[model samples]
Target: MTETPSREHRPEPLWAQAAELISEQITRDGLTPGSRLPTERDLCARFGISRVTLRKALGHLLDRGLVTSSHGRGWFVATPSTVREWPNDLESFTTTARRKGLVARSEVLEQLVRPATLDEADALAVPAGTPLLVLERVRFLGDVRMALDHAVLPAALAPGLADVDFTAASLFEELTARGVVLDRSETAIESRIAGEALAAKLHLSAGEPILLLDQTIYDADNRPILLSTVEYSGDRYRLRTTFRPR
Candidate 1:
């Protein structure tokens, strides 16, 4: 007699199926940055799931930086964090970085709020005592440690960040879903001496040459969302760009 196929052998989870459907909608609709998703009732009806089940699927997408919701606005596909230049546009950091044949990943070293420093206060346009969530990460390319970065975000703005899988996606993508649109950014690059943290994270010896970068990112309302200072191994990465004056 032939044995019946077991339910345990099903290829995907219930929530996963729902997540896939929602993901497809975002792609098919060409959802842009700051686009809002349908309401919970709508998604539930569309996916033929109960409210509890729909929320479960939405939670999964949220953790993956794929969707976001506000108190009254409902959910929306996250706006992508991207950079564009003529013939050279990078829509996502991890995707673009990987396309350059480099391995890219992020570790959520820290994800809690701490009091901002004077510098941080000025950069974020907040008071010195304002609470901020800090994220420290090491970036690698082809088995070589490339950069060490530290990012700070307004604690109140990104309440769900602590639940994100930093190892899997870009922080900017996650922030946008939560309503923090990265409207503009400012960057400063210079050479610097490596510190103990940088030395350890990048596996470099002391007194080595390194590249230092200070980057500030702002929301659509012109409020600072993240402030980061990065240190790159002198021998590992290069910055190259061409410009045509207007």
Candidate 2:
């Protein structure tokens, strides 16, 4: 009688297996930020994988923001402390920074009264030619510039808003003092790569990743009062929120 053939066990995908092995090695080695990873040749030899597979694993790490690559240098671990938790709240950037014991300040870049753009008009539910007060400011944490904020609102809704010293005060607080009661806000977050002007303003290299927050603030009466587009340096901030079961 012929003996039954033994079944073969398939292994995991090479790239995925390599990624897992590298991650384990990173943990076991206690590799700190800026620590250079083993050369690709060594890693390939150790993992019994090809160069392409090793690169795929490294690419996976890079996509997760766990590693970074220099032009001529190999991949290095990213700094964990560089990441900050940002909650999904309606608090002003100034207030959030202050709560964290960091000095927060703003530099007024542009302030003008102009006609609303088509997008702005739609967002504020105003006519295309409606007058709007636009304020652009750069936010700083201590000496490091962290974010750029562009805000627009109906000029008629906040009379004499142009007279306020926005660089020295919180826009939210100023609006509150002006009788604008903000009850809630809707926000959309996205990722983008910095362009020339934005890169210079944020002190980052061109094409660096950044976080964009487009939000609309509403009053207690559910009237939209303000539209803001804020860009934050990605390496310096992380969005975090808690989820609870209903």
Using TM-score as the measure, the top candidate is 2
By summed lDDT, the worst window of 10 consecutive residues in model 1 runs over 81-90
lDDT of 1 at 73: 48
List lDDT for all candidates, in order: 0.68, 0.80
Off by over 4 Å in 1: 1-92, 243-246
TM-score of 2: 0.67
The per-residue C-alpha lDDT of model 1 at residue 141 equals: 41
* TM-score of each prediction: 0.58, 0.67
Query: Model 2: which ten-residue window has the lowest total lDDT?
Result: 1-10
What lDDT tens digits, residue by residue, belong to model 1 across residues 10-94? 6776677778778887899888534678888877777777788779889998777677554444776542322111123213456
Per-candidate count of clashing residue pairs (backbone under 3 Å): 1, 0
**Candidate 2 residue-wise lDDT, 1-246, digit = tens:** 211111233266777767777877789998865578988888888877779988998898877777766544577766443335655788887777777776678889999999999988988888899999999998876655678899999999878888888876898888887898989989999999989899888766778889998899999989888999999877667888889999
